[model samples]
Target: MSISVPQLHAELPTGCSVDRSGFMRRVSGVQAVSPISPPRSPVPLRLSVPGRLLAGGIGLGCLVILMIAGLVVPDSRGVGTHEQLGMPACGFLSRTGIPCGTCGMTTSFSLLVRGDLPAAFRAQPFGAVAGVAAGMTVWAAGYIAITGRPVHRLFRRCSATWLVGILLGAWLISWGWKIFVVVGGLVGG
Candidate 1:
């Protein structure tokens, strides 16, 4: 719980300065390979009771979603698996004759939970990626809830802009991939 921060005038390493945020930042104009500045030391994650409860709830919610996806039979057409849940057909796809961004996401999740990785990716690459992300979230949340220990705490350095930019880029690229698959008649599309 005790931290010893060097005084601002102290002889620290070149280009590194302890900022007001208590993180060692590179103040010099020397261009680093990555914009993200890692913390001087790994910070420990200790969640409060409310935080643990929230994590448990989120993990359970994701689990239920995955379970429901697994229960549904994946459409051979590579989409419309949600229709099995009494959901209506995709309005966007029905109108344009093009698969929507989330057209095969449900099918992909279903396939993934059913242990058909290849088919899941074929159904929708983004769907598979989302499934993996959700699965990881579930695991991390469960670990946090049960153990109240640090899990990948050092990863908090990346800025919100960077994280959102990466996810958005992936989503757009995956949408383009879906278009390619549909246009090329790769699947039932």
Candidate 2:
């Protein structure tokens, strides 16, 4: 059955009504009725040559800053020692005995800085992975800012099942590692 827009509006839940022109209108309330149109497909903005260049420069600068911070930072082994410096390890991992996934990240980064990839991997495999991910993220963000196109769109299109599976897998791996460490300590002692 074909129903008029106004008729559909009138049939809305209580306290909601429609205007004479068949648009949603609030008769008496603090909330104002604003008619919203369906979102249109975004058209690419025509940026000036200088504007594009400026964006590219800014992106490159951000990438440089990220790399400097990630690779040039000195390592220390004290709880809350480098808290003010935004170093990830000094906050929680040092205080707690449990080794976080990124626990030896600073040492890993330091090893990387000293051109010891093997040592970095030995220090913390997860940290090495994180460092690579962070580098890629910075590069992708910079590239997007300059080119106006996203480098990694896979995350945007990920399905719920894929996310669930990833989370479950990570949890299982972490739990298994913890169990192995505990069992190894018991056997050795």
Candidate 3:
């Protein structure tokens, strides 16, 4: 027996049926297939330039306030008033009565605020450098927000090794100086 191609294409099992156009119409009296819609792409999230500027401005403003407070608030008696204000002195060395890497930072900051560069260095050479570096960082961020351009590229290009070396050298020099002072006092006594 020869079956026509259209008949074969349209043919369905018992309890199923096909339309006259040689396509399966239904199975068990139900539609054979349902059409599906294509999936939609996700919408991208974006911040407007004005919104970015506002956020940047707020952040920079907060930083400026902090810098001003740090410089202006006097705590020269060696008793930390900033500590009560939630500013923690270095924990690693303060507990031991030994000068930590950042021991003279407050004194240095005080000297810097007073415009005494030599006194600042005498207090803690690295602290003045750190203060300037931090100020420059804030300035750069504000500059980028305002002008959409980097103010300085040296920090971006500087290597991690250079930073580590500077920090280590500063710490060792400060530690050595403290030791020398202690030794000199013992010898004099």
TM-score of 3: 0.50
Q: Considering every candidate listed, which one attains the maximal lDDT?
A: 1
Per-model lDDT: 0.82, 0.52, 0.56
Candidate 1, residues 37-147: lDDT per residue as tens digits? 776656565888998898899889998989999899998888899999999998987888788888889999999998888888888888998998889889988998998
**lDDT of candidate 2?**
0.52
Instruction: For candidate 2, give the lDDT of residue 143.
Output: 61
Worst 10 residues of 1 by lDDT: 1-10
Cα-based TM-score, every candidate: 0.73, 0.44, 0.50
Rank by lDDT (best first): 1, 3, 2
Q: Candidate 1: give its CA RMSD in angstroms.
A: 10.4
Model 1 score (lDDT)? 0.82
Cα lDDT of model 3 by residue, 1-189, tens digit: 222236565335544555565555445555456458877546433345775586477558647644664655544432243464577875754576555666556655655666776655655567666656555556665656666543335567878899799788977886565445333432210
- The runs of at least 3 residues in candidate 1 whose Cα sits more than 4 Å from the true structure, single-residue gaps closed, are 1-45, 150-152
